[model samples]
Target: MLRYGLVVFIALLLSGCEMFGKKDIRLPIDVVSLQYDPYNYSMAELDRNATAACIAKGGTEAVAVDNEINTESVRWAYMNFNCYR
Candidate 1:
């Protein structure tokens, strides 16, 4: 019983380590934008386009911040970006 308890404790400890392993790094410049398409683009395409636009606007990294789908079938993708030095 003692060995089993030790193993469980170690497993939980290792899992906690993995959970806290990655940290989000924020940059000084944060840019947010939205791309919308009525009939020509998919969600993935919209994300790629928005990320490209963010990079073009001087962001080093771009991330999707939000998405909204309208009743008229319009798809909107929101992106957030952090500029690099």
Candidate 2:
């Protein structure tokens, strides 16, 4: 039982660290809904980073579309942005 709990804890910890660096924004992704794990990040930060990425990809503007927070299963939040060229 104790071993199982420890394993679960480690798994969650590693998963949460998935966004440790700028891996999500390293590539030139499409100007669509950019889903991010808001576990240790702020919405403003996410938006700023995403917009910057868009601009770097030659987008004139990056407007946020929908911002929703899910409280049900697989709780998560999305930062949708429409990139205008």
Candidate 3:
């Protein structure tokens, strides 16, 4: 049982993809959410706001957005994106 546990631990250690094999350096990612209510804002407009916000937040110029609207009530989409500094 001890050998099994040690092997498992060793496996985890070996499988870890890292550098220097000590502390892990995590790159920070800038995630921004541009939310809008239906009928109040369009996807394109929300995208523009999100882009502007990203730029303001020192985020990368890259943008990714998806348009979504409800059928019964107002159109709304939770525009989520991120930028790398």
Q: Which candidate is the best by lDDT?
A: 2
Top of the candidates by TM-score: 2
TM-score to native of every candidate shown: 0.43, 0.47, 0.43
Residue-wise lDDT of candidate 2 within 1-85, one digit each (tens)?
9999999999988887885743544332457566677565676877787778788878766777766666464546677787766
Q: Provide the global lDDT of candidate 1 against the true structure.
A: 0.61
Output the TM-score of candidate 2. 0.47
Candidate 3, residues 1-85: lDDT per residue as tens digits? 9999999998888778453366744353676777667556575776677677777888655355454557467465566766555
TM-score, structure 1 vs. true: 0.43
Question: Which pairs clash in the backbone of model 2?
Answer: none
CA shift at 8, candidate 2, in angstroms? 76
Cand. 3 TM to true fold: 0.43
Residue runs of model 1 more than 4 Å from their true location after superposition: 1-22, 38-40, 72-85
Once fitted onto the true fold, the runs of candidate 3 whose alpha carbons sit more than 4 angstroms away are 1-28, 65-77
Candidates' C-alpha lDDT:
0.61, 0.70, 0.66
